[model samples]
Target: MPFAVLPAQICDVEPVYDVYFAAFKNEPIIEFLFPGGGDRKAHTAGTVQWWNHDRNGYTVKCVDTDTGKIVGMASWDIFWRPGEEGAWPKPDGAVWLEGEQRTKAEGVLVPLWEMHEKLFGKNRHVYLPTMAVDPDCQRRGAGRLLMQWGIDIAEKLGLAIYLESTEAGLPLYSRMGFERLTYVHMIHKAEVAGTEEDVEVPLMVKMPSKAKGMAFEDWAKRGYP
Candidate 1:
């Protein structure tokens, strides 16, 4: 079915949540986020509050025309402003290995603020966060559609899109023109019965607007910037 990329307005919050949960079904952080175990109602309420707080966040939902269902979703926002903390709540009470992970993850945001200054040099930028596609729709081109839409919007506005992603999603971003900025360790402390273990997350980056002449997917296959 043909996919349509539409601006995700306030009304689209619930649908966007569906895509988010579906995409992060296996992610441990998500499990921590919804400790009650995938309560759709709680998730919906949280999303509504988040959207209300950050009205500037832009979302694009990929809807399957035939089913008229939102199969994928991606969100971006203006770069980190001084003293402004972006959303994405910290994982709740850690389970053994997760306690320590939270501390490290919390610290990463500070460096992001520093990096924002270094990369854009005091000028505002755009940051991409929480991108996801339905489990059944994996590898079906929906992610690419949303990514291209993000690139188009960012370029038209003459802004740079920044994001930190997992190792699994690296190829997708690279294909869409994101470059690997660093492979820094993401430290997260999780506690299980008062014990600690650090969870390491790899970080990367890309400048889609700057890669206009290149084919991101091809470049991604070759591990090019």
Candidate 2:
């Protein structure tokens, strides 16, 4: 089926996260975050709250052109200058899941932040928090369509694109020219499971100013790199 990419609207938060939830529901993190499977209402509320005050965020969706149905979604936070991302205002996370369901989020989130800072520090870059294609739509190029949105921004702004990749996402990201830096192991001790659980996600980056097409631009040298 054919697909097209476009910016997502506020009304899209629900469906967008629907695809995301379905794509990641089986992941250990979700199970660890919500304990029992979470309903769409809670997931959508959290998604909305996350984007509410995030001024630097960019979100996009992929639609099945033939059927006009959404197939994938992606959200990224753009850091245009040094220290800007850190200083930016944020939404009150307390508005999301309440009680322990919310507090438990600190486990994966804190470590993820530590790893993020460790990787880029105060440098400007694009941070991909999450992206997902519906399970039925896998291997159909929807992922590439969604990713290219940020790639275009990163290339135009000359910033690096930083994202964590699952094992299944490796080949797609690798083919898109992202270099695998290292594995970031996020461990969350599950009080319910009574054991330590960890997810080994690959850290990847695509640095700008290295576009193959740039070789042919007016400012480029006579020959390609």
Candidate 3:
């Protein structure tokens, strides 16, 4: 099954959301963030909208070339310098959340964002906020294809790439040269069946390769291929 990676368009939202929801639905941190999970899909949809509408990030999709179905997706945002022209839009609120859901969501996200900024704010880097593949499409190279899109761009721009990795994603990221910088933990307020008492996310970073000006063609020939 061959796939092609390209910049995602507005029309790609639903499929991209589907992949993200399916991939993270059972993730511990997602369970912590969404609590009971009734509004998880809606929350994810809103996020997809934010990513697409913000106009300050890159959203890439990996589509099955034969059928044109999106098998994987990845989104990256460059945190701009102070007073930069195109800063990412701040969310007005988690409109998709309500009552307790809203409280829980913010409870978990606020500190996480603060920690992220404190740790990585000084560097001009790319942030990989979301990446997912269809559940059935795991281990088919879709992840690598999607990840390579960011790797290539980061290398070209001489910037490091940062991501918060779930346990399942740690191995693949390690293989790609990302090193764990720190761990972020969030406690669950309400006990849920099959959910961990706490969610631990690893902050990882992959610095640009020292061989900085390497052309894509040469980089591919050397190792990426």
- Give each model's clash number: 20, 0, 0
Model 1 misplaced regions, further than 4 Å:
79-122, 183-185, 189-199, 208-225
Off by over 4 Å in 2: 81-103, 183-198, 210-225
Descending-lDDT candidate ranking: 2, 3, 1
Model 2: how large is the Cα RMSD against the reference?
6.3
Question: Per-residue alpha-carbon lDDT of model 1 for 58-87, expressed as tens digits?
Answer: 778999999988999998775434433443
Question: For model 1, what is the error of residue 104's alpha carbon versus the real structure, in angstroms, after optimal superposition?
Answer: 10
Best by TM-score: 2
> Model 2, 126-163: lDDT tens per residue?
88888899999999999998889899998888777888
Q: Point to the candidate with the largest lDDT.
A: 2
The true-versus-predicted C-alpha distance at residue 72 of model 1, in Å, is 0.5
150-224 per-residue lDDT for model 3 (tens digits): 888888876667787778999899998887763444333434323545555677777677645443234334542
- Can you rank all candidates by TM-score, best first? 2, 3, 1
- TM-scores vs. true structure, each candidate: 0.69, 0.79, 0.78
Worst 10 residues of 2 by lDDT: 215-224
Q: Model 3, poorest ten-residue lDDT window?
A: 185-194
- Backbone-clash count (model 2): 0
